[model samples]
Target: MVEADASWRDESLGARVRVALWLRDEVGEGGVFSKASMREAIKGTEQVDRRMRDLRPAGWAILTYRDKPSLQPDQLYLEKIGLPVWRAEHRAAGLRQISAKTRRYVYERDGHMCRRCGISAAEQYADEPGTHARLTLGHVNPHISGGGANAEDLITECARCNETVKHLTGVQMTKEQVWDRMKELPVQGKRQLLAWVKTDFRPLSPAEKVWGMYRQLPAAVREGLEDDLEALMRS
Candidate 1:
């Protein structure tokens, strides 16, 4: 157990604060730690793992197995520390709670798809076809000095794009590769593609809107509707 005066030992502190303290004092930078051990020390803290992740926005670099290949599934490595949230002034740092209204507005504005990749909620990626993308809200100008929590400041994104942008990852495709595909488009298709590039968003057609909504229906219902549509077309 941590000493009584330790910030991590104080039950009165917020779970996020205590988790940060635990990592700083117990784990240290570039140290390996296990979730089970951290949980045992924090005691009764709901979603301790989430609390640790919450520290990231404040500059913490806690790495899970997903981020580091050498680590065991249950192990995490503390790469870097950010804010000292134990101090009162830094307590709410990087913890911007977007309003429910703002979240809905951003998602609705972006047509419920990732603005970066054009993948709708729960849609599979073209490269990793088996894995479905999870949608989330990302800041339109995340790296800006004064980004805010408003509709204009946010955009809908797949969680993958959000992480990639934050990390400034490599491009998904090369220019030549993409240019070849562009050249393959027919004249009308080229015109349509140029419009999307100019606006930087793909507007869904009315039929596409219906198709997206219809995809959420149960298999039985979808099959029944397909039959109805086929019959109607036959008539």
Candidate 2:
């Protein structure tokens, strides 16, 4: 993945070409171009949006809010041109999806620290407030395990804590067992784990895990699970 703010350029024609070259290098021919995907690839939303706009009618790309790629070039062109420049500017200005907002909110709610390993956002953001940080927004209950995307279902954790929890609890424990083990963790760890009780955290096993936990539910319940989780994960 490209590092955030990899470069700073004056948003000019030459700058746009350079950005396109960077995209060509990073994404290659098979890669699909979209606002979100390019934002991720280039690591600068403003840069990507500006480059896209400046190159418009020439190098057009399209993506759904869900991040899915659109194959129709005409639709892509239409959508890109239809959007107001200011809206794209706002998106490039750091206004992220609902999920990103939720993730940051969860991190702040947890005192801007990793509840599992005790890593703080202060330490992660020491050099730059918005720079990449060691702390991650972890799902207290993973989506694969039937977790929702609600504030009550997530927490801030260091990479270590997030990975450890996933590895330790993913397939080895039952939902109840996972809860039991959570009680034995540190205070922060417990705080992280407790966030999942209100949401479903099904274990990864039989296909029923997905079908039953998600599909078989009532429409409202299923919609809640689906929509909320999507919002939280920014998926």
Candidate 3:
């Protein structure tokens, strides 16, 4: 009976909850461990990497080699563990299952572009050159508790920006710095800025909305449509 009762201490819990427990019990904070060790500890679970990534929005601060160059490629460091997903109260933390309908609505509402950086699906960032953006829904406030699956609570975010916002290195431009740049804008630019700020979102123009949808087409279809649009414009 005691053996069977200890399931929460092991696999009877959700994979993510067990993963959090295993990390807390085994690794502690600021400890480094390899993927092999984690998989061994949490055997029979698929997408262990994904479950680990899911913990981040709950404010767990796991770091990779990308975040900390001292670590090996296959290694991950547990900087801080956030929610105790093993507990009943917090099990739902960071695990909002966004429905397909709501997902589509949020994407369309945001013009199918990442709200954080305005990068459309599969478009390369101007600064990052050659790296393409992959769009995903992110919480309006990722670090907050109970970030639900509701459309109003989510924003379209590219994978890159989503990860950056989760980590939040705390060294971005200050408000004064941004305001100084905003002050440089002309009257029309200032008006456009006011519209976005007032609505707390960037409203897509009709042409831009069409472009956002057009960008989602397959490469060959997009190329053909590009030609078709050009020809129709000339006629």
Best of the candidates, lDDT: 3
lDDT string for model 2 (1-235, tens) is 2223333332332344445454545544445444565555555345566455344323234232223334543222223322222322422321112387787677556665566645443243344555433566666654232245678767777655664554342354477996777778999867655665455331233543344234324557767887888999995
Where model 2 places Cα greater than 4 Å from the true spot, the runs are 1-98, 122-133, 143-146, 170-235
Write down the lDDT of every candidate, Cα atoms only.
0.79, 0.48, 0.82
Quote each prediction's TM-score: 0.68, 0.28, 0.75
TM-score of 1: 0.68
Q: Candidate 2 at residue 120, lDDT?
A: 46
Error of 2 at 232 (Å): 40
lDDT of 2: 0.48
- Taking every candidate in turn, the Cα RMSD to the unseen true structure, in Å, is 5.0, 18.6, 4.4
**Ranking of candidates on TM-score, top first:** 3, 1, 2
Candidate 3 residue lDDT tens string, 111-198: 9888888888888889899888888889987767557789988999998888777656453578899999899999999999999899
Candidate 3 regions off by >4 Å?
Answer: 1-22, 33-49, 57-93, 169-171
Cα lDDT tens digits, model 1, 60-151, are 87776667889998898899998787777778877767999998778777777788877777677899978887788888765453357888
* Candidate order (lDDT): 3, 1, 2
